[model samples]
Target: MELFFKYLQYEKRFSPHTITSYQTDLHQFQEYLQEVYQLEDLKVADHAIIRSWVVTLVQKELDSRTIHRKIASLRSYYRFLVQRGLLETNPTLRIKAPKLAKKLPAFIPEDAFTQLLDQSEFTTDFKGQRERLILELLYGTGMRLAELTTLQLEDINLAASTLKVLGKGNKERILPLNASLINALSHYLQLRSATFPNNNSSFLFVTDKEAPLYPKYVYRVVKKYISTVSTANKNSPHVLRHSFATHLLNRGADLGAIKDLLGHASLAATQVYTHNSIEKLKAIFEKAHPKA
Candidate 1:
């Protein structure tokens, strides 16, 4: 497990959050195996044992997507072990991931985001300015929360109105910034300078003490503001990202362009936003079409 973790960290260059999730999934499976079957070694485990673990997970009422992720983690681990010659056969090769219903990504209403920015009262202090900028950047740039947290001062090009993002799998992409986002970032930079006069932090967003912004702080900030504007089922930073992409698609932005903006590895990943757009089109058609 340690060797696999090192592989993910250095060789694969996965983000810390992803590495942590892999660890948690593996640990949970190992615990289940120990508790139920007294199995201390995965080398002796077969496909039947793995299938039973999946059944146990389903019995625990875990979501299909989550169960699929856990199974994927096991498959990766076993594959790694096989490559290293430690395992004779991969136990997860035949185990199929449960079929999941196609669910559209939940995004904030476009006007709702506008209302929050225009009507909401934010403090004039540094903290308030920084928090507001964080929201703007997330929705404006459509960058992932992890990408936002790792944003550095050097990544911003104010004159060009672009932000260079380090995305999943350590892929780099440039996202153009809108006028509103640029102005907000300018105000935040001024406030940041005043708040931390002697600070030399390279990271773009920082805490009150000038430390780098962690994932939890970003989540809290997004949730606090988004809850006021939306009653979305999931109110996280990714919701803002989803809003960003959905809004673009509705406004006639090209799908391939959106795929690039979102830093999706393939067009299929970006095509999901089309589902939401189609739903909106259905609503418009029902309202406008004369046929009852």
Candidate 2:
């Protein structure tokens, strides 16, 4: 397990959050092996025993998604063990995770999003301007919070109205910007320049002290604005991203284009937004239909 973590960090270059999740999943599997089978170590376990362990996990009432993640972790771990000569053969090769049900992602309505942005307090003050711009960019670009926070000054092209974002797996993609976002960013940059006249930091968004903005700060700002405008659900940055994708899909945007905009690696990852759009269509049809 330790070597697997090293591989994830050094070879795979996984983000800290992903590494943490892998750790948790593998730890749970190890505990199950210890408690159920009384095994001192998993290196000597055979394929049949591993299959039974998966069946036991299913019997524990775990959701399909969680079970699937556990299976993925085990697959990686066993492959590593095989390469290192600790295991003779992979046990997870024949094991299959149950299919997960398609569930729609939660998103704020268009009107609620407008209300949330309208409720944001914009001032000439540096912090106020920075906060407003952060919210605007998240909703405008549909970028993950980590992508936004890691944005550098050179990543944004004001003249072209586009941004170069570094996404999952260290992939780089270009995302177009709307006029409204461009204007907001310009105003915020002017304020940022005034606040730090000669600073060397290249980050687009910065704190009052001229330091790079942290992810938690962005989350808190989003939470504050969301609390005032959205009463239906707990507001977060990801919800805004979901809204961006859903809104685009409803407007007849191509699935491939949406996938590119969201920086998703596969169409399957981008298809979750379609479920939300379908639910919206169903709601509209129910309201407009006159049949008894």
The CA lDDT of each predicted structure is 0.91, 0.84
Off by over 4 Å in 1: 279-292
Which one wins on lDDT?
1
Candidate 2, after superposition: displacement of residue 41 in Å? 5.3
Instruction: Kindly list the per-residue Cα lDDT of model 1 for residues 161-277, writing each as its tens digit.
Output: 998999988999999988999999888889888889999999999898789999999999888888997877698999989999999999889999999999998999999999989
Over all chains combined, what TM-score does candidate 1 have?
A: 0.94
Model 2 lDDT per residue over 166-284, tens place: 88777899989999899998988787777789988998877877888887899899888877777746577898898899999988899999999999888999988878787667877
**How far off is residue 280 in model 2, in Å?**
6.0
